[model samples]
Target: MPDSSAVHFTNAFDIRSVGCSGDPTMFEAFWRETGDAAELVIPGWQTMSYFSDVGNVCWFMEPLFDQQVRRLHRTVGNAAVDGYHVLVGTGSTQLFMAALYALSPADADQPTSVVSTAPYYSSYPAVTDFLRSGLFRWAGDANSFVGDSYIELVCSPNNPDGAIRDAVLSSGAGKAVHDLAYYWPQYTPITRRADHDIMLFTVSKSTGHAGTRIGWALVKDREVARRMTKFVELNTIGVSKDSQLRAAKVLGAVSDGYDVGGGGASRHRLFDFGRRKMVERWRMLREAAAASGAFSLPAETSGQCNFANETAANNPAFAWLRCDREDVEDCAGFLRGHKILTRSGNQFGADPRYVRVSMLDRDDAYDIFISRLASLK
Candidate 1:
């Protein structure tokens, strides 16, 4: 038999090519650079160790778990998680799969179509199909002919667009599941009085705590929560206890004003600073794209929406630009050659001329990006 390891199997389906276009955050690379030198976590997480045994029960986590759940709900004004009793998952991504399991019906009508707006989080379609075994389909745009009996996936301040969908104030409407992954006190205004259950968020984006792989789900129904918990129990045996403990510790410390001290500004301050920097970067890119006359962006920023007031008050953090000129074939590859990576619009079911630029980089790097993009013309 041939040596299995020498088959060069990666060429068959280069999974790395997916999500490979964008420039990863320096922080992520830095964290991985540590290479197990010390515990990868906030200072508070250093207090806890991953030594929990399997035989032990989850009784020790009752209080902290309750606190984390309540804090998430109160901050987001989404009572769905409170109603369902969120089960701690390995990460929000795991919760996402659990949600698919909870919502998907093997014998149901149409095999549970998963729909969302354009320029969505790139992983939505892949995760849905991967976890659902080709049962789930990416139905684009809830308003654009999404047949009945479909679950729409919505992301607020959406991954690439940073646009939040208009929320439905009432219950019993099965439009879609909203991913409030980036919704937080710092990024969005908390004017919510009604809780739209079926939302997922992770500490990765919110607290820069990606390594912990900690995430939470909010839903209004006990049945949904219980079902999701069941799925979690089957996958990875109910997450890691030590991860939970460390997350709880870090959350408590941060809420009580203890900084992670990760060589950046405080949580709120860092977010605020990042937000401002993103807005500035957006302007620079918009100017470059416009100056090149080779691209056009979505009108969401200038279009009518609840965030109209907010958009007017503040600049956007994402640049959803599209290349109208026929010369450009792959926006991502074209940008990559310039040493500036961007997400291809095709991945989000958008036009190839379109590219999504994340504005989360530091001001200096962002400036370099603007210069390079401007020179492309």
Candidate 2:
């Protein structure tokens, strides 16, 4: 009733999508800083690596598959699940489609209503539309469902705005699938309880290996897991075992404390460091934006949306700011001219005054952003 359908452009600055945020781990600089000068070991392994050529699976599949799944298990708290299946796609975007197919019915009378919380991952509706002709409807308000819906896709530390809500798993009529694409230690503290039976994760956010095009799902219900496996089969037969192994190697290294996301002592240490940096950067960005007095952000510099119970985010990687000023019609272009590329909030079903800002980047980048915004005043 509050006209929640409209989103603003400034809200885009609040998310860490690819390229914009610039993951240090993914960059060569990160490895250089770690003093690992070796030129990618794994002699015969990488040569035989069919992660790119997933369709070309040979005898090296099974063992590689085992190694990868185990590594993933260890990384994600080692939850229990039988029948290890791996499917590699171009990116987690493909996996998102696979998840939808696994849940939606082909011949159901009511086009399965796909519901995700407000200010969710921007890709949810896009993927759903491309995958299913049926279309995904957004669910507004935490407690109140937008419409009568069954399948719910919720993102922890949601995109556009890092709002991590307390969602539970209730079987039968109410089912929830978690899009935990950003559940890595560097982005946010790992506090999500595996108490739920169904969940999903992507290598892009966790490993900074978005190019690998690999991701996996964790489900408690044996039947649901089986169906999901079947969905993978239908999508592309199976994920590349080579990618699985590679991911496994990296995950193993992470579990063994060999290669952490932020290269800090523990995942917590990495998270804390990122939190501090994000807070420092946000302080400057917020101040600059505040000078205009046209933007609104989370109460705490921590970027925690208390409404979503996103307490774990001491400081969100991005800043979700809203511009309530009556003058500006286009916030995205306004920032783009200043060389600050951000997403428009309309895509998130929010007001036009909102724009998202990625706070997790080099200090220099943040400084430039603040300087640009300050110039606007």
lDDT tens digits, residue span 1-377, model 1: 35675455543223222223333352343334333332435465542533333332322223465576566455335344434555566778888888877877667646666777776778888887764464456665555644456677777867776676754222243545667766654354434533666778776666556677888776666777767777776776566666776666555433433223434223333334434554555667678877777777655343222321343322334567676768778887777776766778888877767787755444455666667667777
Q: Give the RMSD in angstroms, all C-alphas superposed, for model 2.
A: 8.9
lDDT of 1 at 209: 66
Write model 2 residue lDDT over 1-377, tens digit each, in one string.
24443333334443322124434332222334433322235556454542333342212234543455555555554233354344344355665665666666666676666666666666677766654466344344334554444677777767768776556333466567777666554555555444445656666666455555677665555555556656566667666655665666555444544335546433322233444565566678678877866666876624433222455444555677776656776677667766777777777767656777766555555676677766673
Steric clashes per prediction? 6, 27
TM-score of 2: 0.72
Number of the top-ranking candidate, with lDDT as the measure: 1
How far is each candidate from the true structure, as Cα RMSD in Å? 7.7, 8.9
In candidate 2, residue 311 scores what lDDT? 59
Score each candidate by Cα lDDT: 0.59, 0.56
Q: What TM-score should be assigned to candidate 1?
A: 0.72
* Number of backbone clashes in candidate 1: 6
Q: Candidate 2, overall lDDT?
A: 0.56
